[model samples]
Target: MGLGGTAKKIQTLAEKAEQTYQRLNDLREEVEKTQETVTETGDRVRQLETEMAEQRAVLDAVAEEVGVDLEAVSTDAHITEAESDDEADDAGDDGSADTDGDDEAVDDDS
Candidate 1:
């Protein structure tokens, strides 16, 4: 090949290298932004968890003062929720038949 051809190849390679460098910088910026977002979300979750614990403590104290069996009430509430969910699932199942297992197998195959 001539010197001109060699120079052209080198120029092409340099252009590709520059494009790759820009993409890498862009990806780094995106990763840093995502990390900042994740950190903020984690802090918010912790704050919400603390608030929930405080609220639960106050509710437990109030229930005690009112002579309500908080533990029993909580158990009953869970049972009722489970029963309701079961009923809903059963109701929704009327049209589907026994296809859930088959669907899962098909998904696994895919």
Candidate 2:
């Protein structure tokens, strides 16, 4: 009787240990997947940041080509510029663009 009770206790202990090992493996897999996702997300964010910086550079270049201060392109400037454009359109004016002809002349001289 004593040997049978001891065998049952050992079997129960083995089952619990197996369950614990499976749980650990499951946790390890979850952690690995989480780490991979974090790495991919980090890479994507850096790519987006680089793209945004490039777009900002292009926007700045366009602003310079129009002879306007890119630094001053705030929300207020956007609103005012929009209104000014509407007025110009309504008045049928085409000669009030922000570009300076003298700047081109100076560039030609250089």
Candidate 3:
């Protein structure tokens, strides 16, 4: 009777140990999945940051190429060349020249 009782206790302990091991393995898998998610998220964030920086560089380059003063752009608006010339010509009603510095040669000798 004593030997049978001891064998039954051993069997129960073994079963409990197996259950604990399985739970530990499950926890390890969950931790690995979480780490992978974090890594992927980090990589995506870094990629976005790099792309933003590149876009900024391209914007700066384009602004320079087009002779845009970024600082003055917010405060001032400019008319097109044709509109400006027409306005200047209209303002110069006397047959002299436009005040915007586009002076035509007049026949002063006449």
Candidate 4:
């Protein structure tokens, strides 16, 4: 082959190799960015889980302090239980029936 032809072929091959290198570098950078985003998302999920666990613990403690059985409060049974007319009348007369009984109940449980 002529020297000019050989030089032109070498130039074409070099251009193609440089373009492939640039594309590979861009793809590598994109992969790194995706990895960083995944890591950040995982950290956020873990933080949210920890916050939820702490809030649940606080609620459980409050439920215990208030003489409320957490399982009963969480269930539908409390809502289904109806109040008697006598109980309602006692609750309305002095308001002490509700507060006093609740305080005594909590104290008794402790």
Candidate 5:
């Protein structure tokens, strides 16, 4: 090739390299922002867990004072929740339009 052709090829390669560098820089910035967001989310989650632990401690103390068996209550609550979920799933599977009032009444009685 002639010098002119060689110069054009070099210019195109340089432009491509510049474009690649810009893309890499943009990706790096996005990664940094994502890391910061993840860190902030992790901090919030840890804070929430700590608060929940504190609240649970207070709840246990109060339940003990009121002569309530916390473990039994917890187990009963889980069983009731599971039953409700199962009933809802069954209703959904049957494809029947069950009225909300009936469901609410059953839930209130339990």
Candidate 6:
């Protein structure tokens, strides 16, 4: 081959190699960014899980203090009924009940 043809071939090969190297470097950078994002997401997930566990523990402790059995208080209907009964008892004992019309009239003036 002529010297000019050989030089052209070498230049073409060099260009291809340089392109390949640039692509490889770009791919490495992308992988590193992906890994960093994944690690940050994992840490956030762990923090949220820990916060949820702590909140659950606080709720359990409050339930125990208030004489509430968490195992037994499973449904909204049961909670509503219990609250209604408590309110009825409190009203009955607080002299707020109008057993007769006279008691209501006395309350109306005040």
On TM-score, the candidate that comes out on top is: 1
The better-scoring model by TM-score among 2 and 5 is 5
lDDT of every predicted structure (CA atoms): 0.89, 0.85, 0.82, 0.83, 0.89, 0.88
Expressed as tens digits, the lDDT of each residue in 1-110 for candidate 4 is 69999999999999999999999999999999999999999999999999999999999999899898888776656555544555775566663545655666654653
Clashing pairs in 1: none
The number of residue pairs in model 6 that clash at the backbone is 0
Tens digit per residue, CA lDDT, model 6, 23-101 = 9999999999999999999999999999999999999999999999787777777899999998996677555465664
- Residue pairs clashing, model 5: none
Q: lDDT per residue, candidate 2, 43-104, as tens digits?
A: 99999999999998998889889898665668778899999998986676343543674545
Model 5, runs deviating above 4 Å? 95-110
| Tens digit per residue, CA lDDT, model 3, 1-110 | 99999999999999999999999999999999999999999999999999999998999899999998976764444445667877886776575453554445343322
By lDDT, the better pick of 4 and 5 is 5
**Candidate 2 vs candidate 6, lDDT winner:** 6
Q: Rank the candidates by TM-score, best first.
A: 1, 5, 2, 6, 4, 3
Q: Which pairs clash (backbone N, Cα, C closer than 3 Å) in model 4?
A: none
> What TM-score, computed on C-alpha atoms, does each candidate reach?
0.82, 0.64, 0.54, 0.59, 0.78, 0.60
Which regions of candidate 1 fall more than 4 Å away from where they truly are?
98-110
Where is the poorest 10-residue window by lDDT in model 4?
A: 77-86
Instruction: Give residue 110's lDDT in candidate 6 (0 to 100).
Output: 57
Worst 10 residues of 2 by lDDT: 93-102
Residue pairs that clash (backbone atoms under 3 angstroms), model 2: none
TM-score of 6: 0.60
Off by over 4 Å in 6: 73-110
